[model samples]
Target chain A: MKLHEYQSKNIFSKYGIPIPKGRVATTAQEAKQIAEELGGRVVVKSQVLVGGRGKAGGVKLAKDAAEAEQLATQILSMEIKGLPVRKVLVDEASAIDQEIYFAITDDRASKKPVLIASAAGGVDIEEVAAKTPEKIIKAYIDPLLGLREYQARDVAVAIDLPRDYWKDFTKIAMGLWEVYKNTDASLAEINPLVITKDKKLIALDGKMMIDDNALFRQPDLAEMRDTDEDAPAEIEARKYGLSFIKLDGDIGCMVNGAGLAMTSMDVIKLFGGEPANFLDVGGGADSKKVAAAMRIILTDQNVKAVLFNIFGGITRCDEVARGILVAMDEVKPSVPMVVRLVGTNAEEGRKLLENANMITAETLADAAKKSVEAAKKGK
Target chain B: MSILVDKNTRLIVQGITGNEGLFHTTQMAAYGTNVVGGVTPGKGGEWVLDGKIPVFDSVKSAKDATDANATIIFVPARFAPDAMFEAADAGIPLIICITEGVVIHDMMRVRNYLDQKKVRLIGPNCPGLLTPGEAKVGIIPGDIAIPGNVGVVSRSGTLTYEVLYAMKNLGMGASTCVGIGGDPVNGTNFIDVLEMFEHDPKTEKVNMIGEIGGNEEEKAADFIAAKMTKPVASFIAGQTAPPGKRMGHAGAIIEGGAGTAADKIKALEAAGVKVAKHPEEIPTLL
Candidate 1:
């Protein structure tokens, strides 16, 4: 999950990495208070979990407390890239001498955690990578052995960093690695790790993305999840252990596995129908879980028709059929539903749903065609 | 006749006392997989499945007693890494992990550890291997396949079943089906299974099922173009999925304009492999 800039900086501070003195402000008045505490010269950054905040005018410099409040008011009322700026970070402005780009993320090709660093900073790393490939340096770290001091020093030297700053660079690198490892972060970034006029290094901007699968152990990090960034139906679906992504269309897709769920969506569009959402009830879902998925799908008003595609392996079609029946009794949904049950106990499942006032098909192609027609008729 | 599991395969179940373990163990045994002993900590000397299969306290004891050549793990994600380590240490040549949601870091460590050993790990989140009508290791339904010359390798479970069901309707079956899993950092990849299928003489043709994530499919296409002489068909899912939104699977995300269905299809077609536009079309292409 993506953490806001302020939250990431807080984690960085906890790891002994230096960050500008700041706090998150939810309103203009709070911004003035934080700016005054930081001695009036500050940078107000939007707390949205997206990029190009500067291009969207969500970031501004304030010369004093009054200007800080004025800019905060402007940013608070602004919406960048369709996401409203609900909070801003007011940080003490510092004198910068140089900048560096640094991050640690899993390199899928190597199947290991890699530390990426460059002398170029405060810009799009992808752009730099495309422009000057030699500027980008990477070091792969074994998960068992972890990042070593020599490796960090080599990165520092590769960036042509002066010897005097090697110790501070190594410390920050080690601290960032700890933050990444301890928080189970898929990515930990420090863009523009600036060296101040006094020669102290401080993280000017930070971002951390935690692994969703590791959240069970990192409870503290999990609790920092920003609920406002997620849809309510999505949060509800998570509670039921179902993976659902709402989309803009009329056909609601419910399938047994992730790959099949996506394939079902593709087939719907191939048959000239747009899917309203992608929902997977998982490999071993029971009747209750299936009912929950049905409710979640019906919650979207755009769904004029629902498609139930089950190719049961660990999941039995009979149980999924029973789940649809249970949900039908509770929700009393009016939209048409096309059910295609295959695999284990498929015959029993088909028999149970024969008289349930739903359309039935034998193959995915047939199901898609029927659902598209049903959705068009419903429209 | 199969690449991984076959009639000669003697299998043991880890976490056999758990609900999923006991259930799939019964299914595998019913499919004619030689039922060796099981491993459940503190359940040593106990017997499950109506006193037919013995339960040992550890993989070592079970391996020593049954001389099991292969083992399937149903342990939860938290302890799954340790389970793989134990199986590797016990010298099991083939280890198939059916557990899902294992942390990527843990799997990275497990992958590194298994690299030095003479073991093949299938998945940390996958639906095991199936050698139609002969033996089954993991949770691929025993009834969906029949003995044939086609070798299937997929990154999905139910989608694989969808393709295989269509192939079966068209009078085609599998030599063996392998689910390399959906996690970003799994032990096995498309190339590993593709290489195996390319070498198996009993398998004449291959069908690859990939989704919209990673460059594994593109890499496999290159492997097919450069090395394999057998005919290969391909299907790439999630053409309609939006970028940046994970489509159910952890690895099924299109980020930064890469790992898209369009890219995978282009790569496969450029390699002379018939790319199926739909899941049901795989059999026709093959």
Candidate 2:
């Protein structure tokens, strides 16, 4: 789950990492009030999840309260990267002495949390890595030992941070690490850990992405989920423990596993058909869950047909078939349907679906071919 | 002779009293796995499955009583790390975790601890390894796979079955199939299992099932090119997956324009591993 800029900064502040004095404003009037409190000079940043908000004109500088209100109204009315600006963070502007990039993320290759720092900051870090390459410095934290004081100091030195700021840098880095570990965040970043003209270090911007699996333990972070970013059908699917991703296509796919679900979509594309969405009913799904998944799929008007690909192992084919039957009763789906059930009581599953007016295939190839044809005819 | 488990392997079950644990335990036992004992913390000194499998309180006690060399976990994600540490502390050489949704931090610690212990760990959110006709460990269905020369390794559960079923249809079977799990941080990876398969004499050609996210496939492609003599075929899912979407699997995401199916496929093809265009094409490529 990606945390918006203001939300991330709020978390940073809680950890004693200095951030520009700011409050999230949902309206132009609110932005004006915040600007007035901050002595009239502020930056209104769009609180969207996507990157490149500055390039999209979602970020603007306002010299006075009136200008802040105008900029907020403009931003709030605009959409950046297809996401509307629902909230804007009106932050007290600061004079920059220098900028440095800092972040801690899971390094998949090392299977450990890695701290990344650079002398260059503010711009896209990936772009900098792709261009300069040598400016980036990294340190891998031992999950058992955690980020040691020496490691933080080393990163500070490697990033060419002046010796005067080492103490504050280490403190901020440690605090950031605490926030990351406590929040179960996959990424905790400060794009520009800027040194102000007054020699004070503050985080200019913040971004955090919490680990979804860890949300079970981190209830507070889970509540921060922005529902506006997800499609309604995708959100509904999650309630039933289903993993659903909506795509633009016609064939609705319901499969048991993530891998199988993607493959079902891939095969659909290969067979000259498009998958409307990706839905994984998960292993050992009951009839109720199956019915929920079917309803979620049918909610998409682009779905010209529906396909069920069951390669049951722990998930019994017969159980999935019962799910399809139960779903058929409730949804009464008008779209063409194709069903392929294989492994573990597949005969029983196929038999159960025999009279459901659904096209049944013996293999995935056969199923894809049939589903493509069905979708075409439906179209 | 399979890469991970065979007839001689003795296994213990953690979280044996849970619904998933109990159900898959019976499935594994019915498939002829030597399920020596079980651990359920408080439910020790009891018996389950008609008193055929003894239950113990801790992994240490279970190991001492059953002399079980391997354990498969069905514990919830919250306590899975403790279960792994318990099994490792008991000096169990092989630990297979079938539990899913384990926190990445916990798994990272588990991975670090297991590495120091020199214990071979597989899955934490995976369908465990199946040595066909010899030992069926986790949740992979026993009927779909038969004893044969092809060794299959995948990052998915049902997708592995799809590949195995397709292989079975072509009169081919697996020596063993390993599900490495879809979590970002996992115990055994494609390279770890592929190395085992390469050494196993029963294995001839290898079938690899991969998806987007992580450079494990690229790394495996390098390993196969540099080391392995056996022919390998691979299929990478999510070829058309949109960038930045976590296509169901936690590890299966394209971040910063990296870990894409196209990149993985390109690397694998350059390494002489035939990249299958579809799931059914995997067996034919092999």
Candidate 3:
């Protein structure tokens, strides 16, 4: 749900927060045109989901149109941490008087949205909080009232901004809060909010992460998603309403709940095998969804064996049993599988799998041992 | 004696007409829970589950008519807060929320409002607490649990079952098992349950299950170090989960160099609690 910097800046601009004039360019020619329109000293930043773009050579500054185009071409061809740079944002470079940090994110300890502002910016805030600690000021916003005017002013003063700049800082802070609340953003960050040489404040950098659950209401923001950044299995999983994360292992796990899915992987390792992936089919999934999930797992060639560990609370064992049978009919893969169905109608479900000649275990520990041994024999 | 609920827990279910509410209501009643009434707003003055339970339009009406002492919420995420608010307004002392995916902002508001009352909110995403062979609220399976002297508290659903199953395998049983849930903000926490178990005379030992999340386990370690005299066992999950990523649960994430399994284990171990490497090892440690 993380947005690229350029996308985040666009949302920020809509809220009246000033951002440097910029346009994204996907090619070298487009870069030159954008730099020409902006004129004089443009920063070409590669748009990738990963962090540390500057150290990874995904960001560079150009003095002229030709250099901008050259740098954009270099960045477009580069890959930062295995993610290819598909687009470059050509933006007007700002001459900063000073830099400051501001962000709003969820704080579990307080169970509220906490604003973290620091006079020290343009670096990792965690490092600063761990070291100086006093340079940063935190304010918790009440969900009922939201970020109050007085709270905003307190942050401005704590960051040590001059009186003359307090009004602008407050305005930007209020705007950031609006953008975050409206977009269903889990995080909204403006690192290096710069005061320009002309005594005007601008957001030099922007980062946002939208909440996944809120995406249904935010259609415009949902369309901004880039599936290219996700693993193939993860993408397929969304279509089937399954939660799957690929890992480096041979035992393919399909469990009912999130915690159980994780525990299934851990048990596989404890039984002397590595987990190929983590997949949760969720509660009340029917045959079709299970078939789709099985096909997706079969697509991963690393999976030598599969395991189904279902603990049906809201989910019923009979429904899951039908899912496994339907999945076997559709996939027809050569790999072996160990099935363990516990809770509600488990006896009937176990009967169904046993009749299909599939290996069944009575306990999770036994299922793990069986799956690991079955995978080794398959190899 | 068991904590939270026993024969005295008169239960009213919110969102009683909903699929989850109806299903768990029947399950809880079958396990001997005292199902007094139900609430479904528009479906008030009706009967559900073949007229075994009476339905009311609001928590206030239900509370007035039945004097229900506790309520479990199964409403959708959007209406969950309102449901909790109604229960709180009705002066219900114990509220167990089973609804998941509620926005953190909503919980913050609900928490702020509930702070004024003496209500105990268990979870907005948790599988409710269970007192085996006596009363079962929430979705924890009733068959695997047996009434015994051990106390269990966890932040997960399936992992809680796994822990209880392991104990059952060793001829041990539980007095009560509570899933505080994996939400970032919840009403009851590890400390709350630990405090309850420490005071309950029938409970001899306790098992605490945590994952990579907020510092609940670490804070619980401090509480155990200072006040706990009873034996405590601990098991931390997600040992191989990647850092700084949400691992399925809204609360199960590592952030800012905290909430790692290793950190939780070290904290609990330093507090003189036996920490299990896996769920199977929990019973042995206890």
lDDT of 3 by residue, B97-145 (tens): 9987787767877886787787899997788889998899988888878
lDDT of 3: 0.88
Candidate 3 Cα misplacement greater than 4 A, ranges: none
Could you give candidate 1's per-residue lDDT for residues B1-286 as a string of tens digits? 7899899999999999998899889988989999798999999999999999999999999999999999999999899999999999999989999998898888888888888796899987888899998898888878878889999999998999888888888889999999999999998999999899999998999999999988999999999999989999999999999998987777997878889999999999999999987999999986
**Clashes in model 1: which pairs?**
none
Global lDDT for candidate 1? Answer: 0.92
Task: In angstroms, give how far residue B258 of model 2 lies from its true place.
Answer: 1.5
> Which scores greater on lDDT, model 1 or model 3?
1
lDDT of 3 by residue, A1-379 (tens): 8999999999999999999998999999999999999895899999998778988889899998999999999999999999999999999988889889999987777777889999898867668989999998999988767999889999998888999999889899899999988887889999989999999999988999988767767899999999988988898898777888888899888887777788888888887999998887875667777778888888999999999898877777888889888988878888998888887667878777777778888788899999999999988
The better candidate by lDDT, 2 or 3, is 2
Going through the candidates in order, state the TM-score of chain A alone for each one. Answer: 0.98, 0.98, 0.98
Among these predicted structures, which one has the highest lDDT? 1
